[model samples]
Target: PAVVNKIAAGEVIERPASVIKELLENSLDALSTRIDVDIEEGGTELIRIADDGEGIPADELPLAVTSHATSKLRQADDLFCVQTMGFRGEALASISEVSHFKIRSRTAEDHVGSELAVTCGERSDIRPIGCAPGTQIEIRQLFCNTPVRRKFLKRASTEFGYISEQFTRIALACPRMQLSLTHNGKSVHRLPATNELTERLTLFYGSQTVEQLIPIEAEHGGVRLWGYVGHPSLNKSTRKSQYLFLNGRYIQDRSLQHALNEAYRGLLMTGRHPVAFLFLEMPSDQIDVNVHPTKSEVRFRDQQFLFRLLLSTLRTKFLQSD
Candidate 1:
């Protein structure tokens, strides 16, 4: 079992950024409104996340990290999920297999919190601890037991860059969630909770860039789309700036990507991609998000319809003069 767990960790956790994404997802699943993250040595040494959300009960702490013992979606449904669900099953288990993992959490009703620690798949008995009303998780020495995996890690600066990118994606997806990030001992980002998406855009991109963005809002055929699309002047050399969130879950779809490019076809020069922060809302039955465990890709039931809708929406918006 230990060997299998280590193998799974190798597949799921490719880097510190991957770990960051999983932990952040868990926090969001817990309904955390405020999340604080601290990283040391680019998350090779330590990564700590504290969130103010409903915490795990004392009795459930063990099951939370149990391998392949998911308490969510045990039975496959005929239709794609009607709601966006967090991937909580193998994440904690795989993460614990590769690093020193500890979790301390308390609910509003509990007098005290419970703490659990796992060192390379060796879990300790749960113990009571004093903590605030929420959850705090610490991961230390990532890939420590797997020296081969650790060997492939890039430099601290480069790895942190990846972590920052992941953080940026989540922050943009959930604008109202208070998020803060610290590296080593210095603060990198201290974003206050805001319903305003432009505030986040300005924080990540410059204020000067935000001013040139075009706002899009439209609904058709039971699908609603709204977000900020960068003007042609703000085109990027790469597609990294494009973010499309479906039901608040970050996703990647080739049709959607192609549609975006097509929308800016004549506006952008060759080799340049449009900068966009697009949100999509539609009935869950019309799409299949079971494509990847990472939840980054989904299959739409009507691919051509989406492609045409997205392309026409942006193209038509750009045609109108502000």
Candidate 2:
């Protein structure tokens, strides 16, 4: 069982950035209004996430690290409509399998908090402590025991770059959540909760970049799309700026990309991609997010309809601006 967990951990945690992504998702799942992420040595030496959300009860601290123990899914039907971010129940368990994990949590009912520590799948300690009314998780020496895995890690700078990108992606998806990131004790990003999408974009990109974008809002056939689409003059050499969120979850889909590009056809230069941050909202039953373990790809029931809706919406926006 231990060996199996370690193997699964490798799949779920490809690198230090992967670990940060899982931790951020878990924090978001906790309904945290404010989340702080701190990392060192590209997250290999240490990674910490603190969230101001509903903390776990003292009794549930131990079980929280147990395999397949999740609060997100109450029944089988919940799988079809997973609105929460961390539902698989495998993230903490798998992460603890290969790292030194510790969690301190205090619920509103508790006067004091409880702390649990696990070292590479073995419980080291569990005790009561003083803490704020929330959860703080610290992971250290990630992949230290797995020499082969550690060998595959990139340099600290390169790995940190990936971590930064992941942080931006999560921040973009949840613009109304207060999020901050620190690396080696230096502040990387500090974003306060705001309902304005353009404000969040300005924080990542500059004010000039935001000015180059055009607002998009449209609703049709039980689906709604809203966000900022870059003008043709603001096209990029890479598609990194193209972000699509379906039902509050960031996703990558070729069909949606094709639709977007088609909307920009004849407007953009060859080999250039338009910058966009689009959010699509529809009934949860109309799409499926369980196709992949990472939940980065989703399947829509009516792909053609969605494509047409996106294309037409962007085309109309472009035409109006012109």
Candidate 3:
């Protein structure tokens, strides 16, 4: 249905940062070692992302922005066993629906790459362009066609904060990927590829915050969680610093949050929130990521069991000084 495209677009590209997140994921999936993001006015006016990765092929250029055209997975079974960060392939199509979009992609084999432009899901131009051996996408006037969605956006500074936070999490997950962020031509963050996870954390959270982080690892009952958690003394005044990734996929689960809160019950003062970057790995079939449109929330078959395990492990780590 024609309406389904618009609905899919709404799910894939909710806001500027949501667009930014999907594009960044594509760059990472492309095996890009370096990604540079440049934004103007919190990515509402303009957002440019450049990545030095294996670019899209010439023949695949048109399909890149077509609805449901994805190279991430092939069959329905793949959906039940997704290992990559993004698989729906709806990102580009959705992005094109709300903004002025342009993509310049060149694989290493192709002598020249193609450039395509679309405004509100309508293609205006598609031609060959001489570019480097990589992909560079530029999005402008996000949600300009959808005035209602545009109104939901926050202030530029606030939106930029969310964009920056998402970038930080993605970078943390792929420590080997070098990521840089610039706003209005001024560099806000520049992180070169580093093998050390601590360095990446320090670059994002500052040395003091990084110093307060503790490594976390727990495995039992076909589930494994690993990452860093903040010391009780390093609790934040808000829950913004908490990150939970299920099966290498970033997710927001209230049950997991409750488990964390339970673990910190005796250690943290009231109104304090603990900072964490925990990743839970399990069989993909056991967790349903499609439960949410944005793919930020998940449904676990045994959510209670997962919650209790998280709570017990976190509490034991502190009690036993593990």
Candidate 4:
């Protein structure tokens, strides 16, 4: 039986932030070095993502916004050895299901690309159009199909703040991507591609935040951890600022998060959280990247070793600063 792709989109694309995350990952997967994001009224009105990478072909344009369609993977084994940031292929479809979507894309080989317009998972128009060799996606009236979801939304200001933080985290992780974001027609962030991670960190966080960073590096059993962490005195009022990435992908593993906090045991005041931005790199086979639908959570085969490694590396950083 052929399942309805429309119903599935409702589960995958729930909010504006979710749409933003998926589009950003697609840009990264396309090896795009530059990505521009523009949003209006916390994405309730408009959200647009433009990337200068290999765009979809005229024929693939329809499938690109169809459920369960992906250019990232083909087989079950590919899931285990994942390298690209996204594989579900549900983002575009999901976003299209709940909002007004228009995709203008062109491939290098074709003189003319195609434009696709979809409303709530229904195709209203698909036509050939001349455009640059890249992708531009515009979404409007997010979550319009699901009135219940809209009811639960926070204030526009609060939602925009969350979106800003998400983009900043992604920018910091992928310093090589020239990222720009705007809110309500005003520019809020513009990060040019740079080889130096420190500069990106400084730009993402202010100069004041960078002043508190301490560099840390550790290698054990072929795996290496490298990055910066905030000083004990610079503990944040909340844990939102704390971040960790594994091979340039942001992740949240309970084991890893606990190991980090345990390393800062006595250094942190009660209820305060220390900030971190560390990258853990190892053999791809050693980690299971398919644990989460969003690809933000990973499960390691040797969980104990990773936990210990994270704790020891962080502890050494704190000790050296003493």
If candidate 2 were superposed on the true structure by all CA atoms, what would the RMSD be?
A: 1.6
lDDT of 2 by residue, 1-322 (tens): 8889999888888899988888888888788899999999898898999998889998898888988888785443244332566747888998888999999999878999999999999986679999999899999999977889988999987988889988988899888889999999999999999999899999998899999999998898888999999998998999889999887777888899999999999999899998999998888778765576575787888999999999999998888999
Candidates ranked, most accurate by lDDT first: 2, 1, 3, 4
In model 1, what are the clashing residue pairs, if there are any?
none
User: Which residue pairs in candidate 3 collide?
Assistant: none
Residue 12 of model 4, lDDT score: 68
- Candidate 1's residue-wise lDDT over 237-313, tens digit each? 98888999887878888899999988888888888889999999888777775676675788888999989888988
lDDT leader: 2
lDDT of 4 by residue, 149-177 (tens): 87787877777887887787689788888
Cα lDDT over the full model 2: 0.87
| Residue lDDT tens for model 3, 56-138 | 98888889998777887544324433244564778898888778999999999999988999888888667999999999999
Candidate 1 shows a clash count of: 0
User: Between candidates 2 and 4, which one is better according to TM-score?
Assistant: 2
Q: What would you estimate as the lDDT of candidate 1?
A: 0.86
RMSD of candidate 4 to true structure, Å: 2.3
Candidate 4 residue spans exceeding 4 A from truth = 1-6, 74-83
RMSD of every candidate to native, in Å, equals 2.0, 1.6, 2.3, 2.3
